[model samples]
Target: MNRRTYLYAISFAIFAGRFVHGAEPSSIRVLVWDEQQREQRQAYGDQFLGEAIASHLASLPGIVVKTATLTSPDHGLSDATLDATDVVVWWFVERVVSRVQQGRLALVTLHSAHWSKPFVRLMQERAKSDALQQIPEAERATARIEYLNDQPYGKVPKADAPLAPALTRTATGWSLVLPGCIFPAYRPDGALGHLTTLLVDHPIAKDLPKQWDIPQTEMYNEPFHVPTPDAVVFEERWDKGEHFRSGCVWKVGKGTVFYFRPGHETYPVFKQREPLRVIENAARWLGGEVRKNAP
Candidate 1:
C-alpha cells in the first residue's frame, strides 16, 4: 500500500474503532439491489447475484444487509428501505439518486450498471458541475446551462466521436453533452482480464492486490464516455489489448458514487475474493464516511 492508502486505512480503523465503541451506529445498513435477470441463474444457481452478495455482506461484522429485486414491492426501494440504508450496492433505481445527492445514502454500481439510470443521471449531474467550474466565478450565477441527451442505449460510440460529458461555450451559456455512459466496444466471450490497481492508496482499493486477473470476464474498451472520474481505483486489460478503467469513483452533490465494471450475468465474477472485497470495502468506507459527517 502507498502512503495515501496507508493513511486512509488507518483513518478507517480509527473510525471503525469508534463505531465499535459506541460513537455511532454499530452496524452499516446495506441494501443490495439486483435486477434478478434469468441469466444470473447460470452462475449463481438458486440465489440471484444480488442475494449472493447480500448474504456475504450480512455475514461480515459492522454491516446489516438486505436483498431487494425488481419483483419486490416498489421495486424493492420502499421509503423504509432507503431510510434505513447507508449504502446501496448493485443495480439502480431513479429514486435513489436524490437520496445519494443529499448524503443520505451512497451508491455502488456494478458491471453493466454503467447504463443504469442512477449512474447516468449522476454522471450528468457531475457534467453540469464540471461545466459550471469553467465559467467565471462572477458569471456562474447568471450562466444558463443546457444539457444534451445521452447517446442511445447499447449504441457503441465511434472512436472519433467527441467524448461525452464534454462542454462547449454557447451563445447564452454552456451546452453540455451528457455522458454516453457507454464505451466504444465490448467483447463478452469470457476472456481473461488482467487488472491492475491504479490507485492502491484509495480507500476502495484497500487490501487489494496491485495486480490480479479475472479468470473469465467480459471486456470493455475505452474511451468510456463519462466525465473524468474523481479517482480511478483499478484498470483492466485483456489479452487482445482492449482496456478499461474498471473501478471509478465520483462525488456528486454531497454523496459518493462508485462504479465497478467486472460482472457479467453469466459469469461468477462476484464470487471471487477481490471483487467482493472491493464491494465490502466500498460499503464500509462510504457508509462510515457518510455517518461521520452526518448532522
Candidate 2:
C-alpha cells in the first residue's frame, strides 16, 4: 500500500477499537435487597418486597435490576455483587452506605431505615459538621457526644414529652445529641395518611400529586431525631393530626442519600401507584440516569 494509505488504515483501525472498547453505553445497575421477612406478605402477598421493587425497576428502560435476600449467599452482598450495582434498595442492615460514602453509589433508605447504620453514620457526620461550624477551632478535639434517649428501642414518648434535640452546645465544645428514632406513640389499628408535597420542584416529587392518601397505614409521630435534612420533599400526616417528615434527602460525599418513609412491611404502601413512582423516580435521580431533556 502507498505510505498515505497505510497511515490512514492504521488510524481507522485505532478509531474503531476505541469506539468498540471505550464507547459502550453504560446501563444503571440496581440491587434490591429485602430481608424478605414473612411480615412483608401482609402487603406484598406472594412476591417478596424486594422482589416486587426489583420487578418494577426491571421494567424501566436502561435499568438492569436484580433482587437479593438475607438468604442469598453472602447475604446477597458479596464484593462482586455490590461492585456491579449502582443503586441499592435496602430493606435491612447498613454496611452498604460505607460504599456510598466512598462515592461508589447513591443510597435510597426506606421507611424504618432511620435506624440503619448508614443513616446513623450520615447523621453523625452531619451533626459533627454542624457543630464544627458553630464552635471555635480550639475546642474541636474535646467535642462530646451525649446520648439523649435513655429508653429502649421502640419506646414512644408522649406527644408533650421533651425531646433531646440535636446539636446542643456546651462550654468546652458542643454536645451532639439526638432523640430516639421512634416517636412516643403509634396506633397499629391503622389510619389514613395524607402526604403533602413539601418541595414540589424536586426531581423526586416529579409527577406527584399535591396531596395523596394512604387508605390504611400505621402512624409515626414526629421529632424524628435525625440531622436536619438538606431537603424535606414530602410530609406525612394522619387524620388524628400526628405528622412526620416522610421524604428527606442529604448530599453525602460525591452522591446523595434519600430516606423515604412510607413503607411498613405489613402495609401495601409500595403497591400504590404514587409510592411506586416515588421509588422509581428516586432511583433514576440518584443513579444519575435521568436525561436532561427527556420528559
Candidate 3:
C-alpha cells in the first residue's frame, strides 16, 4: 500500500477508537422512597410524582431511578437494592434504618420530611431557635401562610406561639409544620457558608439564585452540618423548613450523595422551578457532569 493511503487509514482507525472509548455515561440507581403515610402523600401529591420525576431524570442520559415508597417491602431498598443505588432521594422514612444500612444511603429529604427518621423532631426544633427566628419578618410571614395553608391535615398539641392566629384558619388532616416557623436543624456548621468560598466556582452552582430570591414557597434555613463541603452550593431563604437549608453532598467514602431539601410543592416536584432545578442539578452532580457550572 502507498504510504499516504496507510497514514489515512491509520488516522481513520484512531478516530474510530476515540469514539469507541468515549464515556459510556455514568449509571445512577436512585431509590425513590415513600412511607405511605396518608398525611405525607396528602402533602406531596401522589397523582403526578413517579412518572414526572422518572421522565425528567431519564432525559438526562445515562441515569436511571427505580422508585419505592415507605410501604414497599423493606421500603424497596433491599441488600439487592443498595447494590445499584448511586443516589437515594428519600421521599420519607418514618423509622430509622440500621447504621450499617444508613451508611449505604445518600439521602435527600423532601418537603416536611414526610417520614420520621432519627433526629427529625430535634432537627426541626433546632431550626426554629433564636438563630432562625431572626430572619426578616417578611420571611416569617411567608412561613406563617404555609403553616396556615397546611393546617387542615391534623391537629397536634398546639405550641401556643406568635404564629398561632394563622393556624386558626388551619384546616384538618395534618399540616406538616408546627406553627410553621423556620426549619430547625442539627446544623453542626451553623450558618450559610459563602457559596463562592465553598463551591470554588463549580458548575453546580453556576446558575444558582444569588440569594434564593424565589417567592411563594417555603423557606429552608441554616445551622446545618454539610458533611465535607468543598463549597456551599445553596442556601434556601424563606423556605418553610430547615432540611433544604443545607442541601448538598460531599464525598463520604467511595460513593457520592446529593442531599436535597426541597420538594414540598404538591403533585409534581418540577412544577416549581426551584425544586425542579435542584433535583435536576443533584442528579447531574451525582453523575459527575456539569449541571451547575455553579461556582
Candidate 4:
C-alpha cells in the first residue's frame, strides 16, 4: 500500500474501533434505487436490475433492504423513506443529493452514477476544498471557479471530451479548477478487464481475490478527474490499454462516499459473485454495520 492508502486504513480502523466496543450494533437500512431502464433487460431477465441487487442484500443478515425505481410515485423517495434509510446504493441520481450533503446518509454510487448530480456535486466540493487552501478567507465567497470543459452547471461534457487538467488559480481574480469528474474517454462496447486489489487489508477488499477477471464490462480510461481518493482499493485494466481506479472512497462531510465502477446497464456485471461481494461489503462498511459476528 502507498502512504495514502496506509493512512486511510489506519484512520478507518480508528473510527470503526469506537463503535466496535461501545454499543450494540443496529441493523442497517439499505435503499437500493435502480433506474430500471429497459436496456438493463439485456443482462437481467424478468427481474429489474435493482431488484436483483436488493434480493442479494436482503439475504444478508443485519440488513433491512428496500428496492425502489424511477417509476415509483414521488420517484421512490420521500421524507419518511429518507428518514429510514442509512445507506443508499444507487444506479442513477436525482432525489438523494440533498440528503447526502446533509450527511443524513452515506452513499454508494454505482457505475454510471459518476455522472450523477450527487457525484458531480461531490467533485465540485472537492474542487472547492483544493481551491480554498490556495486563497485567503477574504476572497472565498467572491471567488468563481472556471470549470475546464466550460460546460454549464449540472452538465457533463460528452464521453469523448478531454479530461480536465489540474486545478490552478488565475491572475484575473478567479480559480481555474478541473471539474475532475470525467475521464478522457470510454469504451461502451465492453472489454475484458483484469482487476487487481490495491488495498488488501481494507474491509471492502475482504475475501476478494488479489486479481480477478471481469469477462466483459464497459471500459473507462483514466485519470479519473475527482480529487485524490482517501483510499483506492482496486484498479482495473483492459486488454485494449484502458485503465481505471475501479474502487475509490472519500470522506464527504460527516458521512462517506464510495464509488465502484463495474456494472454497465447492458451487462450482467453485478450478477457476478465478486462484484456482488464488493457491494455487500461496501454497504456494511458505509452503514457502520458488522460484516461478521464476533466470536
Candidate 5:
C-alpha cells in the first residue's frame, strides 16, 4: 500500500478498537477551553465567552458541557476532567494534542486558534506525513527528513514567496518546511464577511445555510500557510476581494482537527445561529454522536 493509505489504515484500526460493534456513548462530553480575555466583556458582558458557549451547549440534548478558563484549577483540565471528556472545543490549548492523536478525544479550534500550539504541532505532523508520502516506497523506510523552522508570527508572506509546508527532495531524503499556520494578511476592523458552505452535506455544515454572513468579524486573507486540509467545509469572502477557507478539517493521527475561522473576542459572531450551529455540529460529529445516530 502507499504510505498515505497505510497511515490511514493504521489510524482506522486504532479508532475501531475503541468501540463495540453496535454501542456508542449516550451523551457526548464536551469541554470548552477559553483563554477568557477580559476584552470578551465587550461582546459577552458578565458571562465570559467560554461560559456563554458552554451555556448554549448545555442546553442541547445529549450533550454534557463544561467550561474552563486560564484561571480554572489545573486550568480546568485535570486528568480526571480530561478522562471524562470526549471532545474539546478550544479557543486555545495545547495539552490535548497527544490525547487527540491517541483517538481518546477530538479537537475543534476556533478562529485565531490557527496559531495555537496544538494546531501548529498537528499541522507540522501532517506536513511531515505529506512529505513522507512523496518518497518512493522502496526508500520510505530509510528516508531521512529534516523539518525547517516556521515563519515568524504575524509576518505576512510575500505574494511571490514559496508556500509553506513545502517539501524538497534531497540527496539523502527530504527537507520539509513546516506550516506557519498563518495567512498573508488579516484585518481586525470587524467588517462584514460573507460565507458560503462549500460542503453542505458535511456533518459540520449540517443545518447551516448555504450562504450566510457574519455581521462583524476580523478579515483573514488567504494563501493560509498550512498543509492542505482533508476538507474545506466553508469559504469566506470580503468585498475587497480577499477570500479564505474558513472552515477546514484535517486528520491527525487517529483523530481529527477542525478549524473554524469566524471570530474575534470583541465581536458577537458566536451569538449568531450559523457559527453556533457549526460549532455544535462539529462537536457532535467529532464526539462521535453524529456517526452513532447515522442511519
Candidate 6:
C-alpha cells in the first residue's frame, strides 16, 4: 500500500483500540446520495458520496450500509430507506433536499455540494447529440490508458475549466464525454477557503496524514470563501482552505443527520482516509447506541 493508505490502516488500528476497550459498537446504516450522470458516466461518476466511509464501516460488525441516490425511487432515499437510515451523505447540487427536518436522516454534505458537472455533462452532451458514435479508437484507447495509469485529470494550476483535456483524455474511462474535453477541477468560488489548511484531532481528519496522497494525489483544493468560525475542525497547512469540520451531529425525533462537507468529484475521495473516518464515525453516531434500537 501507499504511504497514505498505510497511515489510515495504522490510524484505523489506533482508533479501533478505543472501541475495543470502552466503546460498545452499534450498527450504522449509511446512505450515499448518488446521481447517475448519464454522459460523464464515462469520465467519472456515481453518487456514493460516502463510499470510502461505507467501505470502512462495512468491515465493522453490526454496521449495515445501503446506497440510495437521486436516480432511485424517491431520489433513492425511499421512505423505508430513510426510516432505516441512521446517516445519509448527500453531494448532489441539483438534488431537491427535503429539509422537512425529521428527527431521522443525518445528512452529510460534501464539498459544500454546490457543483455537479458530471450531471451537467449529461444534459449538455445529450441535448447536443445522441447519434454519437463510439469514441474514436485512438482516443478511446488513450483515455483508457490514462485512467489505468492513474492520471485522469492530472495536476492543474487554477481553474474555471481545469479538467478539460486532462479529463477529456480519460473522460471516456469515467464514461463522461468523448475524448478531448476536460472537467473543471474547481469553480471560482471553490477556490476561496482553499488558501491554507490546518490539521488536528478532528475525527474526519484523524487519519488524513495516512490517507491523503499529497505529492502524488489530486484534490480540487477549492478555497472556502465564506468560511464560518469553528466551522473548520481541521486545516491543511500547505493547502489554504482544506479544512475538516471535525463532525456535525444533529438529533432527530429518534434518528439523526451528520452532514459532512467533504468529498469532491474533483479528487474523488471515494478511497481516501479522512473521508473514511468521517463516514465510519457518522455511521456509528447516526446509528446510535444499540440500546436506542432495542426493546
What is the Å distance of residue 273 in model 2 from its true position?
Answer: 0.9
**What lDDT does each candidate get?**
0.73, 0.62, 0.37, 0.65, 0.72, 0.35
C-alpha root-mean-square deviation, candidate 1: 7.7
Q: Report the lDDT tens digits of candidate 4 across residue range 160-248.
A: 65445355667776645557466667788877989999999998999999999998788888867777789999999998788999999
Would you give me the overall lDDT of model 2?
0.62
Q: What is the TM-score of each candidate against the true structure?
A: 0.87, 0.79, 0.47, 0.79, 0.86, 0.44
Displacement of the residue 222 alpha carbon in candidate 5, Å: 0.7
Off by over 4 Å in 1: 1-24, 87-94, 150-154
Q: Which of candidates 3 and 5 is the stronger one according to lDDT?
A: 5
TM-score of structure candidate 2: 0.79
Model 6: lDDT to the true structure: 0.35
Q: Across residues 1-295, which tens digit of lDDT does each residue of candidate 2 receive?
A: 1222111100000000011122224545566766666777877889867777778778878656666665788866665655444444332235444545555456677776655545555555555566576666776677665655433244556867665445676565456555454456557665789999989989999999999998877777787776678999999998778999999887655446777877666777777889888887787676562222112
Candidate 4: where is the Cα deviation over 4 Å? 1-25, 87-98, 136-165, 178-180, 289-295
- Local accuracy of candidate 6 as per-residue lDDT tens digits, 1-295: 1222111111110001112222235434444444433422222355233344455666777765555444567765454544445433333222213321222233344443322222222223322222123456454434442222122223233435323212233334533322221223433222322212243454444444533332222333433211122335443322443433323333322333333443333444445454566556544543453234333
TM-score comparison, 1 vs 2, better candidate:
1
Full ranking by TM-score = 1, 5, 2, 4, 3, 6
Per-candidate clashes come to 1, 2, 38, 1, 0, 53
lDDT by residue (183-212, candidate 3, tens digit) is 233232223322221353555555556544
The numbered model that scores best in TM-score is 1
Model 5: pairs clashing at backbone N, Cα or C within 3 Å: none
Better of 3 and 4 by TM-score: 4
Q: Which numbered prediction scores highest in lDDT against the true structure?
A: 1
Q: Which order, best to worst by lDDT?
A: 1, 5, 4, 2, 3, 6
For 1-295, candidate 1 gives per-residue lDDT tens digits of 1222111100011111122223237687666766676787898899778778878888898887666665788766555555554444323345566667777666777777676667777888888888889888998998887878754455667878888877788788788878868887889899999999999999989999999999988888999998899999999999888999999989888878888888787888878999889988988888777776566
lDDT of 5 by residue, 203-235 (tens): 999999999999999999988998999999999
Model 1 has a clash total of: 1
